[model samples]
Target chain A: MKQDVVIRTVCRLIVPFIQIFALYVIIHGASGTGGGFQGGVIFASAIILIGIAFGLPDALQRISEKTNTLLSCTGLYIYAGIGILCIIFGGNFLGYSFIPLPLDSAATRGLMAEIVEIGIGITVMAVMTSIFYDIAVKEDM
Target chain B: MIWEFNFALFLFLILCAIAAITVRNLLSAVVILSVYSLIMAVLWAEMNAVDVSFTEAAVGAGITTLLFIATLSRTTRRSED
Candidate 1:
């Protein structure tokens, strides 16, 4: 598939832009038409595009299974860790207003929300990509 | 709301849905399903559910298509019925 010059060139030209757009969606979730789930899926789609265009081996090399597994765990931990932090700060779990950031409560809550969104995006992306990998990988039966 | 455009999209959505179910070829049915997802995304966008629309476009049209194709490669391309 990589030998196909047109597909290779087109994918190369577009993948970076797609990733950037996905990041934009993730970060701009607070103010615009995106959120963790949408952004994460978009990002995973870019990788899936690469996997389709190039091949599974090439894609797995870019993101090894071990790293993907770790990332999935890390993303979930970040979300749960934030909730725990909120509790330790004398608030209910996930109650961002009580987060002791050096800002007004509302502003701090907004920041925490963004952080949680990022964490969710990471987990979603990792899990989606991992599922694709598991399903798409060819077995030597 | 642009009632005319929404009606047109709904029409296309219904057509695609029927085609997807009735098509004998599994691969063609998958393609039709992707089209259905596309129309649904546009409908969501028209209704101002931009987030849902974005999700539909990405997951439904993109990743879901790939997954279907992958599964197709592992199985028969023709439907029994």
Candidate 2:
């Protein structure tokens, strides 16, 4: 399919804002009405829009399949690592209070919660984009 | 104030849902489905489930619509009777 100039220009102008808002949702989930799942899906929608506007090749250049796979793994590892960290500190799995940050335990737990949310967001965004890419691309003869 | 707005959203949601299922052209059905998703997002927001609303808009309205269009491009536009 041929790319439309208007669509490409509009998407270029809008994508950055969408990404920024997704980040805001992720970071503010602790205090507001958002979380990793919602933020990640929103971020993936922006990337998917880029793919629709520019084409699959352009989107792949921005985030290759290899990079997507790696990021998915890294995100899961980060989540699991936090749980292990809590275990090491003599707390149950995912007990953020055991993290021992410079702040008070409650604040440290909040900080850790945000980190966990980021990990979940990364995995979700990568997986959704990868699934779309795999479905949309045509196989070579 | 809020209840009236919610009632309007719910009405629109039902209309979109019926349109999405009954439309003959595949592309139009997809567009109507997207509208349904958007309306559902608004309803969720009205209920204070911001996270669910955000997910519905991003995934259901946005990505799913794109994927539907992509698939539509690869296949027949008309539904076979």
Candidate 3:
């Protein structure tokens, strides 16, 4: 897609703010509404926007396949890692009570929720970008 | 935050849905579908689902429109029926 230079410039400016807001959602999920799945998809949109206006080559240049894989895994593992931490702390598997944060158990739950959101965001970003790339690579017209 | 503002968005989506399915021209229908997606995105945002609203705006309004446009190239732009 050959976007006008002005359109491309505008998208470049706007998309990063979208990403930042997505991160804000992910972080504040416990305090507000939307959790992991929702925040994740939003964060992914930033990259997708870049792909839309600038094309896949430019988008991919910024976010490599390797980084995508790593982040996707990291997001999921953050969730899993907590379970492992709970077990190591001699508590039930995935139990939030075992968390040793400075705050109360309720606050700990909030922290855990944020961590999982981050993980979900990474995975969503990667998978959605993959979808965009697949579309971009379709057979000739 | 804006309950009255959201009522307008809801009405917009309903209108888009009606236009999408009721249109005679296939290309026009497809374009309406994209509009429906955008309206749906706005509705989601009004409901405070920023995450979902964002995705809907990006995918529904953005990618899905492209998909419909691309498909339009290969398919007939009007229903024969």
Candidate 4:
């Protein structure tokens, strides 16, 4: 479990940047190529990198099982809530423009899409991290 | 898409794939599989499938490799078969 000081230092320095970039990818996904899935994976990778460099116990302490489970569900609700809202507004499911937003049709659609992407990103990040934790954590430990 | 670059990448890709399957060490195979994923990501980007390329790079090369390594920790490093 002993890690080099150099590895720990590098991981500490790089994790924040990785997280910021993940946010950027999620937010910009509406207009660009990267989306919720990619952003979420990137975020999870950052945590995984920390786990690898530090230790599983440290990483789990940072993001506990309860927090992870809550996050995954919260993301799904955000995504489905939007879709159901559209239906309640007399449009088909996920009909973003149907929501009674003050903005114009295209703008409303864009905004809804962004929210959905964020939700997706959150769910993905939590799930992927949890998957890593499950696979990596030792039974005896 | 330059033919020469594509050809070189494909060559490397094939080699990586072969090595990944044939390598006796599970860790080496996992590393080689990661290399294969990276080359495939580049190929996807070259073909204008940037989204797919990004996914390949993130999930395929990044998370999958880490998961494989994590699994390796619980088991033997060498493959008996």
Measured by TM-score, the strongest candidate is: 4
lDDT of 1 by residue, B3-53 (tens): 898888899999999999998999999999999999999888888888788
- Give the per-residue Cα lDDT of candidate 3 at B54: 65
Give per-residue CA lDDT, model 1, range A72-116, as digits (tens). 898899899999999998999999998777899889988988898
For lDDT, candidate 3 versus 4, the one ahead is 4
lDDT of 2 by residue, B2-25 (tens): 888888888998898888888899
Which is the leading candidate under lDDT? 4
Residue pairs with backbone overlap in model 3: A75-A119
DockQ, ranked from best to worst: 4, 1, 2, 3
Comparing 2 with 4 on DockQ, the higher-scoring candidate is 4
Please give the CA lDDT of all the candidate structures.
0.88, 0.88, 0.75, 0.96
Among these predictions, the greatest DockQ belongs to: 4
True contacts kept of each: 0.77, 0.68, 0.09, 0.95
List where candidate 3 sits over 4 angstroms from the true fold.
A88-93, A138-141, B1-15, B22-27, B37-81
In model 2 chain B, where is the ten-residue run with the lowest total lDDT?
A: B1-10
Indicate the worst ten consecutive residues by lDDT in candidate 3 chain A.
Answer: A132-141
CAPRI-wise, candidate 4 is: high
- In the range A16-127, model 4's lDDT, one tens digit per residue, is 9999999999999999999999999999999999999998888989998899999999999999999999999999999998999889999999999999999999999999
Task: Tell me each candidate's RMSD, in Å, in order.
Answer: 1.5, 1.8, 4.0, 0.9
Give me the TM-scores for chain A across all models, comma-separated: 0.94, 0.96, 0.87, 0.97
Model 3: per-residue Cα lDDT over A17-115, one tens digit each: 888887777777767765666566666667777876887678789887777878778877887898789899888877877888889998887677677
